[model samples]
Target: MEDRYSAVVDLQGDSKQAAEFSAKNLNKNIMLEVENKDENELVDVVREGYLTTNSGFLKEDVNGGTCCVTALIRKGNLIVSNAGDCRAVMSRNGVAEALTTEEHMDGKANA
Candidate 1:
């Protein structure tokens, strides 16, 4: 989020192009944070980051970061991304379907 905030800081007057640039850069940064990893891994890494108070609240201390959900809508389709334990569900044909996988949070990880 620091990257996102810093990126848009220069455009404080908030022109249309700046807003668009901010949005796009934020999306790109999110992707950069999780390169080629699966959703569950992302979830665990974020959880671990928050679990660690090691760096004492610095932006670069991403290993001890916060939790968030990232969603983008374009061309009538929604692309959702998440870290930590949030779940996104949809109902179809009177049945509920979870579009995202839930990360286990029982303090147990594979050795």
Candidate 2:
């Protein structure tokens, strides 16, 4: 459990760093303001981070685990991604809303 938690934390931290670094470098270069390029880069960074973390675990002979990652950027972008049985929830007013749908063992959403 601890290892899994650490992996998720590392992923989040790395992704955040990537986003910040991308924004800083891109802001300095005026030629990189293409449409949706920043968003695409953010997505790729998150995906690569997840893959790297997973591969690291496999290389270390660690057991598999699940994780839910939620990243809220300063630009009002809310990104939520998960694997296995994890899910994300948000509270609106007095009601609870699920940001992500639950997944069943049969590879179907449990909504």
Candidate 3:
């Protein structure tokens, strides 16, 4: 059996530092807090992860960030969340299924 994990953080405009920080922060929280959590608890963890990352941004930083996270827990449950334009997709039997919707600058879903 093989295990795979993927997470992404993309900052709006440019701020590579912000993106890096958000990614690391989110990954850390997920690694520490997600095990044995239910779906609702997983959502809460993701939301709090975003809040913690956002709180770390400098006051003068105008850049925003997008995040897409996926996790496979025990019992074969997969949890996914998207926090901006970033998206998550799954491939099954040569077909691609979008797991998340993309958000535009106006905060509209680009489905």
Off by over 4 Å in 2: 1-37, 103-111
> TM-score for all predictions?
0.35, 0.49, 0.60
Per-residue CA lDDT of model 1 for 6-103, tens digit only, reads 35343334244433443444445445545565654554444343333222333332222233445544345455544445667678999998766656
Q: Provide the lowest-lDDT 10-residue window in model 2.
A: 26-35
TM-score of model 2 (CA atoms): 0.49
Over 4 Å off, model 3: 1-13, 35-40, 58-68, 72-75, 103-111
User: What lDDT does candidate 1 reach at residue 102?
Assistant: 59
Model 2, 23-68: lDDT tens per residue? 4442233222323357546555454445554544446433434454
Question: Can you give the lDDT of residue 70 in candidate 1?
Answer: 51
Task: List, residue by residue over 1-111, the lDDT tens digit for candidate 3.
Answer: 999998756534555666777677766755566676675676666556555556665453567554555454545656666665577788999999988765443532222
CA RMSD, predictions in order: 13.0, 11.8, 14.4
Worst 10 residues of 1 by lDDT: 53-62
Query: What is the TM-score ranking, best to worst?
Result: 3, 2, 1
- Candidate 1: clashing residue pairs, number: 2
Clashing pairs in 2: none
TM-score result, candidate 1: 0.35
Residue 2 C-alpha lDDT in model 3: 100
